[model samples]
Target: MNALTGVLRYLGNYAISSVWRLGYGARLFLLTLLYSGESFKRFQLVLKELYSIGVLSLVIIMVSGLFVGFVLGLQGYNTLEKYGSEQALGILVALSLVRELGPVVTALLFAGRAGTAITAEIGLMKATEQLSAMEMMAVEPVARVVAPRFWAGVISMPLLAALFSTMGVFGGYIVGVVLIGVDEGSFWSQMQSSVDFHEDILNGVIKSFVFAVAVTAIALLEGYDSKPTAEGVSRATTRTVVTSSLMVLFLDFILTSLMFTS
Candidate 1:
């Protein structure tokens, strides 16, 4: 009886805490949006954050994209060859990358790389009382710090996703056409014919943009709400990555279903 009571109590507390955090996160997101005008007013801050969040993430994205494409090419060719439809390998690679893998994988990578960085940086600022100091100096940390990073992430994510898809296509070409001896003309022609701009490319871009908003918002909220201590900062950073990754995947499913449910 005592164990059952304890279990119920724990579950209740967990549910309440989750609700509180969600409400707090929603409030923070609204506040960030409200104060985002400062970010645009001081465009250089957004540019600086773009370099930090976007430019720094390029190496991992490109390398991972290339490898993903290579794997898709090799595996796709093998599978299609069995069915005597290997020429369709190009469309397979292109569709897979453009329609799903590119945005999803890039978002996952961004969450690990840039999302954790945003959380740690802001968490440390909170821990060190820097945000408090800003408040004392009549500066809104949300406007000055959080908003710029938010817009930067919003702008960077789609561009990075596009670059990743482009690199993946190039890698696929190298693997399929050069190494695997698939006809270059057929590969290009099939990819061009089968990949619809509105359906495949545009939808991928939309997914990346939605993922950007979720990831950036979650990272900033985790950092801002973390307890003001070293341990708290560390935990917040971990939560940022885990939560952002999960949110991206969840949103991806919803978006994919809505976009492709024809």
Candidate 2:
């Protein structure tokens, strides 16, 4: 009987947590729309955060994108060369980079770099009562901290993903056309003919934007809810990464289904 009671309690808690997470998502969506409607002074914070996340993250993004493109070109050219579709290297590279790999990989990297940092910094602040102090100062912490981070993530993830895709495609072109003896016109022509702008690429970017929102929310919530202790802050940081990454992956599946299916 005791064991049965524990199982029931566990199931109840799981159900509650799931519903709580759903509500949290709905609230964040509403808050984001509200922030989008606010004054320029409020909206400008998005740009500031965007610079920090998107611009500051450029170096790593470039390195990852360039190498991925080069590798794709090498492999894709080899694979298609026997079939007389070496020109399709550009199309392969563009599809993989833009439609799937680029945004997802970039978001994973962003979660590690900016996402972890946001969680740790905010969690530490919460532990130290800095957030509380701001509240006492009549500063709405969400408006000042969470809002900027949220908007920043939403705006920057898509742009950075685009940058990664473009650079990766450029790298592929260099490898395929300049080095591998494929004609530039053939490469571009194949890519243009094979890739559709709306169905594949745009959907991926939109998904990445939603991913940005999820990661920001998980990280900020972890930080905001940290207990008043060093250990607690540390725990929150770890939880933030685990939770945010899981949410990104899960939502990617959900959003992909919703976007592609009837």
* Tens-digit lDDT string for candidate 1 (72-118): 99999999999988888889999999989999999999999999999
User: Can you write out model 2's per-residue Cα lDDT over 99-134, one digit (the tens) per residue?
Assistant: 777877888888887887777887777877888899
Q: Rate the local accuracy (lDDT) of all candidates.
A: 0.93, 0.81
Give the C-alpha miss distance for residue 68 in model 2, angstroms. 1.2
Report how far off residue 66 is in candidate 1 (Å).
Answer: 1.0
